[model samples]
Target chain A: MFLPMVLNSLNPLLKETFVNELLKCNERTKDYGLVLTPEGAESIIEARNNILNSLGRVDMGIEVALGLIENFYTSTFINEENYVSVLNEFQEIFYYMKNETEDMISDDKLICIIKDYYENLCGGSLELLKSCLEEFIHDFRRKAHTAEAGLGGEE
Target chain B: MEQRDNSGQTLAVQSKINSTNLKKSQYTIALLNESFRVGLMSREEINNIQIQIMQILKELIARYTKGESSSVCAYTAESILNSILYCIDAYALGCDSPEEAICHLKSLQISKLYERGVKSVSRWLEEARELYKKVRKNKLNVGLESYDHTINEDIPLYFTNCGIVFDAHNGAASIDYQLTFDDMSINGILYMKNYLEHLWIENAFCKYFNSEDIEKLLSDFGRTIGMDYKIELINIFELVFNNAVFAILAGIPEGLRISQYHFDLLSGKLKALDDSEIDKYICQTVEKLVKNMNICELNILDYIYRYKTVFTQRVIRLVRIDSLRGIILTEKEEIKKGYTILFENGKEMKIEDFNLFIKKLMKLKNTEDKIALIKSGIESLNDFVDLLASDCLFGKEFEALFNELGDMELAILAKMALYEEIRSDFRGLRSVISEKKESRVEWHICFVEFLKKSGIDRIESIERLLGEIDYTEISFY
Candidate 1:
């Protein structure tokens, strides 16, 4: 129904830029024995677009994907076998967290929080990490509500 | 193909350029649609504009998120997009014609058009502020809380909290003050500017009369509406304007004051004319008002003329129904002088005596004997009203008492029953008195039912007595 909006996400120029930017991430991840081929990078970009569209979000650049690749490349849980799929799942989770937090937390801070939960808390189990993040989001919302009420009382 | 008419002359082809085809508020969308429909713009050009709008949205979203996030929810994105279109609409409306606006849209960059629109919105906001200042300076010295809050809190809050960057088109205020001729088609700061400008003009016109007279006019208007003028959210300009027209029609020397005598005079004068005659008379009186008041401001004159048609129609309807008192307001002092009941409470009977009297009246089977006992016992109007309130008078007894009362006594009872509905001439009193709906007060319902069953001559006499009785002279003994 949103023809114009769908066309916007389908712009060839934007797709090309996202693919090229994702491919450049191999330069840093290759040192850690994790590399993404051009085709894999294209798939990752396609995954990002699908996730963003489903979540009713718009991304101007490939920052979220790059952040995921950079933050999780050093982890022992990521390998060549699971590299592309894990990055795709992390991209979806990252955008979901952005909406969950109401975009209050900064990009780098949110990614650090998620990486910490994935490594130390969930021991790199994606399912445990998802549940852990949900708990964190619930607590985050309660704190925000309390803070807002406090401010209202002060006013 | 040029076709020849029967006279052997070529027929003139009508151009498809209609200025009103574009809505004032949705100027950009309307202009682009019109442009594309007429082939002045192509699908490719329209798509390019949409793409450019998306690009601008991306830039704005970056600023909104402060680069912390690269995306926002679809609702936020759409809101930003509408704000962008709102700015573009502002600029397009500033252009002389839709064709000119479309030409600019095709030639200029979308960002540049948005920038120009932002500038226009900023200027309009400033103009609205100035108009608000003038409105505050010349505001009517009335006691309406809604009007005060609209001026003192709501509009100022809007100015302070309006997000010009992302939501320039949103009218972020809760305005409660109503104008007689408010234009609802406009939105955002432009609507606010228009409202304030119109309000300033209305205030300026009201300033022509002294404050006391305007205050009295509003009070009288409140009385007719059965509300406290201090709390009601009536448009002050409407009351002042209507009374000014009435004052002119009644041949008052000057000012916007209409006394009870003047209202009665105007009522009689209007009743003599038919519908068309009333229309013609009002039209001429409005013209005379403009000339006599020396209203030179074109905006004020235009504002008055804008309401002339509806006002003339209302007056004609009221006259046709013989309810001109609805528009013609009399001062409260004059109303007090006109309706005096001189009600003095008789000496209260001892509780023992009152209880015995009530017991004796309740025991009497005949309605006449029961009413006679109550009338002989209840000497004061208060006692009589209280006796009615006490439920001592049964169903048949109430009608029996009403039949026994003289015209003046019935008039007194009717006045108390229909006090709120009675304006100068008790217009429409019969309908109100005869309404079948039961009143919350038991005595009121019974009294109205009795009046409904009474003879037409009796009702007319009570209506006449309602006019002659001076309510202000009422005193308790």
Candidate 2:
């Protein structure tokens, strides 16, 4: 009973859903060997659990994780040999983003910004994607603490 | 009532148990209980009352399970049960006949429980005991208002009774004793309120002493005990008294005993008690008490009289302008001229006109507004003091605001604020900056290099801005 509960309880479901979404991310994405292995899937599940436990239950945990994975999977940076290492990096980035953004940005919105930056601004570098996320979080937090009345999306 | 459904079968509408239904059911039980005791109620009446009460309680419990009244502590299944018991008792005691008792019980308001003697120390605590028993038996996860919710870990802490006896009986052998509850529980607060309220009710303290008399006694005690002559012993006593009452309410068992923390704060060793959980609890509880209590006979001010310092200290701790140690003033005292006032940013300004400076500084509330004033060229020591006390400037914002101000001292101050945020090692940087006291220009250069060594990325840009002395800009002093 506990086994099924843990397996089904948001974390594993999120990991499964994300990996399935990554498989269908794009046509060229499939040729790049960007698929997550069982071990890779397990690590995502562990990281998801850790994030959820620390941040309490967010309204969009699965969507956020899936969004990050799908965005990463579809990127031009996802080479055949770098898939495993990239997946590991994605886990850390996703975890960091969740906390740094303070769960204010919805999964869909955060994904939109990342996809925009990855395709247009940063020219498909994951390192630049991480930098953009850090800058966004810093500015987002600063405005949140100071400009309570002025910020539009927050309300 | 049956109604025909779309599928042509008769549907029976369920009788809902809402707030109105609950009140009506409570009234019915109360009436039945009264009649049953008076031997006017039939056996059927008793059975029906039992079934009705059970149904109402079941609905209340189900609502609790669904998280209703979860945020609020006033009403719960246990509390409602206790309310039913109290109503029954009040009806039984307040009236002679069953008919009269029914009328009396129906008129007894929840807020009037105090007047009805249903919320006295003995009655409320008896209900609490029963509630705790039920909680233990059922292993329910309900929050108890009487218990300290702040305690996360189960450490074995117990109550230590520190009883105080007042010997003010006109030189006669008269004594009044007060007991301490070393535990944090609502019962302790209620007990303290009960004791103090009883004193007011009986005018027990009046026969021997009054407020002024107590003040004189405290002063005598202070002198005999070698307490600081500057410290108002009467104010401390009143504060301690109110604090004791608050502690009881917050389920703090320690009562009103001065914790080592309070002593540390009083002695300038600790700058603020706001960080302390116990202090936070006391302030919150006292605020709640002040808002809720309605005493026509006894003014709360009379009890707390001229003791605003304790509350002020709880608001903002003013440390010494020179040594940066917290000055334990019950209220804000105007500083003398030539005293160097320090900000949290480690910048200090020597005041030329102390009284006027404080008067202006007290008018402002945030650092950003103060910085804005400085930006518009309001050159004064007052603006600097206000900036120090203001809350708006934090971490990166401090760096930005300092950049806009374009003062060398502020640049140094911004570096201090940034270093504080990153928890960077400042030992070597501090020694270098302290030694460069030859000229203001030399010290500024040394600090700029130190900022670069400390990994402040914007040092050169800040240094270039600092070179063009905007005398039109406000000085740090």
Candidate 3:
């Protein structure tokens, strides 16, 4: 009840700020024949909030969502018909991978990595993108372990 | 409202109440709960305060992430919330009373209270640092590992690693050095500061005597407790203070050392007194001891007076049991006689030589030839223990070796095998070893099991011989 009250107080303000930011994304995406309606932006914000809450993550603002939209809107595979749903799924995967990576990757770097895999590697296949991210996380952990061992040996 | 007392008389409850029942560490929560219970605060007001705290947490999280990430994990948020609450609690404790703290909580913003708490923590940390310096300067020159580690390592690490912003409530140091009376209520830098202040007072009292005398007193106390003085975690001040009280009672008010003769004299005198007489004598002696020592620090004097009642009770109980010797420790006189068996470990043999010696011993058909080969071949104690562990000797051969060994050699083997259990009471060794069947090494168990099967006369001689062996002179390899 207390946690709900805290999130409730933060919800409306966060929704408004994010909705405004998502609508502003339409200005750039319109060049690629992509535009988000107010209803679509609201739905995206709601889905983002659900994913974040379910993952036990707190977001300061709509930066990561905006970053995802900015990177994926220019893709050749995305169209207006599948725009909202695809953005919602991308938000879910972004947060999941964020947690899986243990927050070791910065936001911008993680966004760049996700965008690179989605656009070039996975060819806009959501399932393929998820698997690629998992593999990337595994390799990252292995490399980190090896680096730690090297440092320990030096010490 | 009027409340009924135990006598069934009605008394009007006052508006203001004392803060005696409030816990200092949990001042805010305790005050809030108490105010709510007394009907001074409403449920709606408490909810509003919680909402304010949540708002403060939201802002803190945003600052923590630097406006980049929209959210953090639940664990991070909870840690930040606890830090925020810690700051608020620190500020609440600074108020004059629980009533005033509750009033401030209701009126002021949570952010303002958190800021004040942060400042108070910073100020207290500085004061604690100064107190630590004083404690180090006046530290007693005793060889206590815990004391030295606490002063040299733990406190310095705390100052270097304490996170005031995110983990203000955590007392970062593992303080192993114990005080005479430790307060476990308060926490964080406040607790550290209070601990240092009390330690300074205790160190001040101990500074009255020479460090060598205190060291000797600690050594004697450890001997009384059946432990080595250097490694034991005994409080130096408590030992010195208790012995000083006994020294005064023994008519040696000018010094701290109490000899065996002094203990005997005091034992006879204390046994004749009743409980009340013992109390009166101890109180007068403590007063005289304080005056003679010229301990002028009021804090130290108050500390000593506070422990007087407990000390008096302990003395009276010890007196009733005719065991005042537990508290009044006499100096341990070193044994002067030369030991019958001076066990010096021989030089280690080469691998080929050791194998050839074992081969030659095993080929011999009789036990006497094997014993002679061992006595001449196995030079080092390691090789001897290794031989016992090697299973070269069977049942009758083990008995033959035991028959050949003298009482002193058996005692030496017993001392090595049962190093921990071998105390002043040699009679308890058999039962202790039987209870603690496990030992440090494989050879130790084999040696002890053989010694247990040896006859009662041999066992009794080994126990008597253990009493004569000066364990300090012999080194176990």
| Candidates' C-alpha lDDT | 0.78, 0.41, 0.77
lDDT of 3 by residue, B238-354 (tens): 788888988888888565799989989999999999999999998999899888988888999998998888889998999898777767778875435454552356577777887
The TM-score of chain B in candidate 2 is 0.22
Sorted on lDDT, highest at the top, how do the candidates line up?
Answer: 1, 3, 2
Best by DockQ: 1
lDDT of 3 by residue, A58-134 (tens): 66567778988878888898999999999898889888877887777767778889889989999999899999988
Mark the regions of model 3 whose C-alpha exceeds 4 Å error after superposition: A1-102, A150-155, B1-21, B42-44, B58-78, B321-323, B335-477
Deviation (Å) of A72 in candidate 3: 4.7
DockQ of each: 0.37, 0.01, 0.35
| lDDT accuracy of residue B45 in candidate 2 | 44
Candidate 2 stretches greater than 4 Å from native: A1-35, A47-63, A70-84, A101-104, A138-155, B1-179, B185-209, B226-477
Residue B304 displacement (Å), model 1? 1.6
Candidate 2 chain A: 10-residue stretch with minimal lDDT: A1-10
Model 1 lDDT per residue over B362-426, tens place: 78888878866876777667667767877777677788887777776777777677666653333
Candidates ranked by DockQ:
1, 3, 2
Off by over 4 Å in 1: A1-20, A23-62, A73-75, A79-84, A152-155, B1-18, B271-277, B333-477
Could you give candidate 2's per-residue lDDT for residues B59-150 as a string of tens digits?
44335435221111112333444444444444344444334443333334423432353334345445434443333333212121111121
**Model 1 steric clash pairs:** B339-B469, B339-B470, B339-B471, B340-B469, B340-B470, B340-B471
Evaluation by DockQ, superior candidate among 2 and 3:
3
